[model samples]
Target: MEKEIKVSIACMTYNHESYIAETIESFLMQETDFNYEILIHDDASTDRTQEIIRQYEQKYPDIIKPIYQVENQFSQNIIVEYINHRRAKGKYIAFCEGDDYWTHPEKLQKQVEYMEAHPETSMCIHAAKRVEAKTKRKIADIRPFKESKVMTVEEVIEGGGDFFATNSMIYSREKLAIWPEFYFNGVVGDYPMVIFGALQGEFYYMDEDMSSYRVNSEGSWTQREFSTIAKKKKHYAEVARTLDEIDEYTDYRYSQAIQNAKKGHQFYLLLIQGKFKEIRQEEFLDLYNKMGIRYKLTSRMKHYFPGISRLLIGIKLNLIR
Candidate 1:
């Protein structure tokens, strides 16, 4: 006479009016026997997103609970609040955003069963089908590791280990509850959460592609253009700050700090080379010092020599552009 475990699906949305209905329909079609709830958090958007969500909430009153925000709180804040407040009753938590929809109806059932059977794992993640939203094309398939693997903090910090897409992760409530202050400030929040999960225990990886991850230019983070020198420098500074904060307490503290510092230095170089716009020499030099690049020759050598150090430092800049 034990109570059945419940799962809560945290579906966050912004202005995804075109895809919101499809996303909600997918969750409504889940073929799980156990009790499940879909908690939708909608940031204050000036689109028809609220209307669509209200429609679903009215139709599926028992299963769907919608939290429509009056003011705009970015994804980082919304996710933090959703995780803290909405996950009260569920023993397990899963995530899918408004743009992404679940492809497999049995995804919840399969993942919940796997986690229930395997107590050693803190979370279970599966493969996802990457779809380009504009063309509705299948760009690629993101697959997870073959078997259950224990990930170290260093591997996660260096971004070397296999990672599951945020939409595909199903984690235990007990594991998530430990980190109450888990809010991300940078462009990458999922990475830190995955690292935290890995540090807690082994992660189960299912090779099946059960979810779809839609990539489009309409979303909040993706829509902003960081092409200007000021914008790029500000972006890198925020990234460096977030990484520094993570490193301050984590085991791979020093290495992550060095990595962030190197990144800041490269961005500084780009700003100076007129690839972006001309920044103040003093300000640029101050950032270089903060990033631990004191010698002017060292900075010049990186630009002129074209070695591995230059390659590693300039990789992200090239990729973003």
Candidate 2:
């Protein structure tokens, strides 16, 4: 007889051969009272990713269920999430992508215990370390670092996509099933997903850090999209459109916050392309006025003295390194 699954881990991968092994091992290490399953959706990886996946699937046929795609569904604009959602059988859903891995053996067990006790929590999450894959150096912590144990939806939204790391979240499947159409429409993945999950109720947070978020790694969306100047411009523009649609769908509840995020991207686009004059335009009026004195000075230099603006901005960017 099949053990009734308590959680379905939603993981997606494409050409992550270098990192998939560690990801699979981490999932296999999860310890819990109720049975849990890892659902891996592989989108036509040209590397040895499928070979490694098959080996694990063969050994743990009941736990590691994977879908091997012939062609890339993401390229075709298919939300791979909806596909996994249909296949997931658990009462709860957790996430750990192919490139990221959990660090604790009891990660799942602790979260399951908490959710079973708290009837009102929509999700469970913990602090995560953002590790630069190449350098193996820990960068700045993923912020909106909460002093409170329970995170309200408003608090999560105020974090501006910095609150919950995808690899660190476990959500109630019942709440997820009732998600609105806007969740499916956003091109930005985790931002909208986290927002929708937070809407279900308060989220339970564990101060224990249990996972690593690999940033700017090869085959990561961050690295691939920012590989060229054109891609960064196009990517930010697409994000603006996607988030704008979500802002409309949410009835302006989070309108100002989302608009501010979009404004930051627009400024980055202008700054990178050397379009300094537009930084002073009316579209950015509200965001510009809200900035600190330093940023306000930068904008003034961008408009009045473009040459000085580039050098100063370049120096600031270097200092950030």
Candidate 3:
């Protein structure tokens, strides 16, 4: 009889030749009691990423399944999540891109144990470390809490797209199979996935840091999508619009929270576009009040010293990503 697979790891790659081997190695190192499969989808990479994946597939045919695309489907607007997910044979689906890896050998085992015990959770996420992609330097730890707790839909919306690390998520396949309308419509995947999962059932968060998230890596979404001011504006606009749709979908049950979340995105939009005066509007006071003293000083100086404030604002915007 075939071994029962408990987890299916979904990895999508483009030009991740330098990092794909490490990603696959991390998955292979998982010390799980149950069987698991690695499903890697290479979107017709021009580099050696596909070659590396094929090597691993040949070495571990039973555990590593791959889809080698003839042409780039992502550019054609095909969702990678759905493609790999359709072939998944596990109870839970874990996400890790080719550019990222898990730090803990027992990451999957620990998460699977917790998920099995808590049938109420539709998704589970843990803490992760953010590393500078080029230097591979440790930047910071993305710990959502000091202790384990359940995350609510409201909190998930407020946290935005970068709320939790993408590599740290393991969600129920059943929950994801029934994708919400908003999930299909959103420009980004991670934020919508968490929102849909939270709506389906509670999201249990473990406080352990077991994954490494490479920020602004080449071919990563951040690098490709937000490289220009126009792209940044468009991305934020789509996010806020998606949040509005979710509000209506939920019959305005979470309208207040959703509106606040949209405003937060708008705040960054205004800040980045150098509309410092508009940021002082009454509607944005809640976000403006929470700004640091130095930022507040800069905002004030924009009135007297427009040139210096504009230069400072440019520097600040670069760090936003």
C-alpha RMSD values across all candidates: 8.9, 4.7, 3.9
TM-scores for all candidates: the values are 0.71, 0.81, 0.90
Candidate 1: minimum summed lDDT over ten consecutive residues — where?
274-283
**Which consecutive 10 residues in model 3 have the weakest lDDT in total?**
295-304
Per-residue CA lDDT of candidate 3, range 1-321, in tens? 899999999999999988999999999999988999999999999999999999999999999999999999878878888898899999999999999999999999999999899987899999999997866677788887889999878988888877799999999998767777887788898988888888888898899999999987878878888888799889988988888889888888888878878888888878866787888899898788899998777756875688997897679757764
Instruction: Rate residue 152 of model 2 by lDDT.
Output: 64
Model 2 Cα lDDT, one tens digit per residue, 135-253: 64677565445553887666666565556678988889988786667766666577778777777776877887888898887688677656788887777777777677777777888
Instruction: Please give the lDDT score for candidate 1.
Output: 0.69
User: Model 2 — which ten-residue stretch has the worst lDDT?
Assistant: 139-148
Sort by TM-score, top down from the best = 3, 2, 1
Better of 2 and 3 by lDDT: 3
The candidate maximizing TM-score is 3
lDDT (C-alpha, whole model) for all candidates? 0.69, 0.80, 0.89
Q: After superposition, how far is residue 240 of candidate 2 from its true place, in Å?
A: 3.0
Top lDDT prediction, candidate number: 3
The superposed Cα distance between candidate 1 and the true structure at residue 61, in angstroms, equals 0.5
